[model samples]
Target: MSHLLDNLTVHPDCRHFRGDLPCRPNKTHGYVCESCPVYAPVTSRVLIIKLGAIGDVIRTTPLLRRLRQERPGCFITWLTHTPAILPQAEVDEILKFDFASALQLQARQFDVVINLDKEKEACALLNTISAKEKFGYALRPHDGVAWPQNQLAEHKFLTGLFDQVSQANTMPYVQEIFELCGFDFRGEEYVFDTHEDKGFNWNQLPSSGPRIGLNTGCGDRWTTRLWSDEKWISLITQLQQAGYSPVLLGGEAEDARNRVLHATTGAAYLGTFPLPQFINLMHQMDAIVTQVTMAMHISIALRKPTILMNNIFNSHEFDLYGRGQIVGPNRECVCFYRGTCQLGTSCMEDLPAEKVLQAVAATLPAATILR
Candidate 1:
């Protein structure tokens, strides 16, 4: 009986141990926990809850680097809406924001839980999560309002509350998140899984000259950041005249407008694609020019030379990783984080195509001088 019981003993602490089914090591090598040569015990269990926009999820990946450096062999579980964007190699498990995922998370305990989002639902979830230590925002039980969980999170909380404080702030988004989690930002680069080997072929795109991607729309949510059609035409003409191949890029939201732009300027518009394919397509570009949208984050992650057009938000909030430049209008924008322009006329109009051309020229490689 004792020998039979010994055979049934399982090592739950082992990193390769999975309760549901046979682990990879056991399946591959037929090694029991006692005799496994590559056995690795988990040091810590960490949970990150960041159910925000897709762009926010992409930018938040830098924190994973800090976590791995500080706590080696830690098992990390991340909860986000954009699970496809998270790198599977970095995260032990990726949970989407849904009732079932929430229930599973609430049932488990973690050594540390960090909620990077400030939405009421996210804060409320953090309140119910079982963790020895918690960071970032949490819901106030008394008033049911979100508040900073610690001193480090206070700055981010305040910035979200007031536009003046946010505009005056100079801390980059990466540094702010690191400080919130009691870690110093060491210029860790984003961990984006480009899925390059997924059989994507971009042979038809112009190969000789620098292929410049012109992301057309800023999304419908932030129409205040939209550049005029005439400006896009001007920029495309200028780029073509300067010997750079201009390619228009956007999602379904900008498909119609991109077609119009392509027709007007004779630039290349390959149509929009799903997220994964779009990422791989953007990878082929030599440089990117986009407004403050998801493309900007993708470009940053891919480390492509980017010219980021800005108007509403503080330019300091972005960290381009030394590979990009943020260009704003000549005049100050009256809209600060507002979806619509307060002046009834957008400041994006003030951002001339010539200025954007200059920024692109400065950001691209020196060899990209006219064909």
Candidate 2:
């Protein structure tokens, strides 16, 4: 596998810590392992720290699978803010921490503490953990730290670190993290084990035809990623005309938005359920139609057919979650990992309702539609 730097030109600021720091070898610094104390190779007890958005948490599932497989006996723990989003089989323990109380998180220790969060506080907390081996992105230029200024770069850097240690080239960057930790890196996609069976009442739902779960609301900037109410109404009308039931799902915060959407089209909108219950609900759908968010991940994890309507700044890495459908604008979306679109016209808006509906139909198999 090629190093991250090999594929892309390094930013000028990244040169300072090339070989000396934990980053890939470039003009910057050298590897930091020489002076760093080598922890005795005891049975692995891994702790993965990823305090990121819901979509990001879902994307990390492959990493978890790899780590568990490499060391079957190793105890793996996950430190994440949204523990509810993590699949049931990913880790042995889930340590949920609030960013507001980050300092208190240092109390727990493990054999290896890998910090996947980008915030400076996450780095500070890594220092506090009593783990024998500490690995994470370098916020400031440390004598032996890796620096990744952006989200895509960070993913590449972290995966490179795992590759360096494990010498595994077959697995992707995220999966490499697990392989490096001595875990199996194949199969078992992202999964959510919801205790409550909030799945749709098949009897209550129209028993006659295919059901497509429509999910709006990206949670942060509501207006940017979502289609207009009118567009949703049109899409629902078209789907219904084509013999499909569009089940609307979203958070309580989106209740009003969904109400307007439902009222406009007379669709069955199940608004604002709890996280676990929402996931359970997802299992009932034949396929999911959603914007780029946790819903896409959840639907994919459940093995339900899905169609993701993405914005300009969408990350293709999300495709790793499932063999689902995706719809987006026809324009060249330059902002791959930007938190928000800088361009005046958000790319998602460019996607026509007809185009989205067509993509969905094309992606779902005849059997899936019949089911």
For each candidate, what TM-score against the reference? 0.96, 0.71
Q: What are the candidates' C-alpha RMSDs?
A: 1.8, 15.3
The sequence of per-residue lDDT tens digits that candidate 2 reaches over residues 253-295 is 6789889988888788766666776787777778888876778
* Predicted model with the maximum lDDT: 1
Model 2 clashing-pair count: 17
**Predicted structure 1: lDDT:** 0.90
- Candidate 1 residue lDDT tens string, 76-170: 99999889989998898899999999998889999999999988989998899999999999999999999999898999899999988999999
Please name the candidate that would achieve the greatest TM-score relative to the true structure: 1
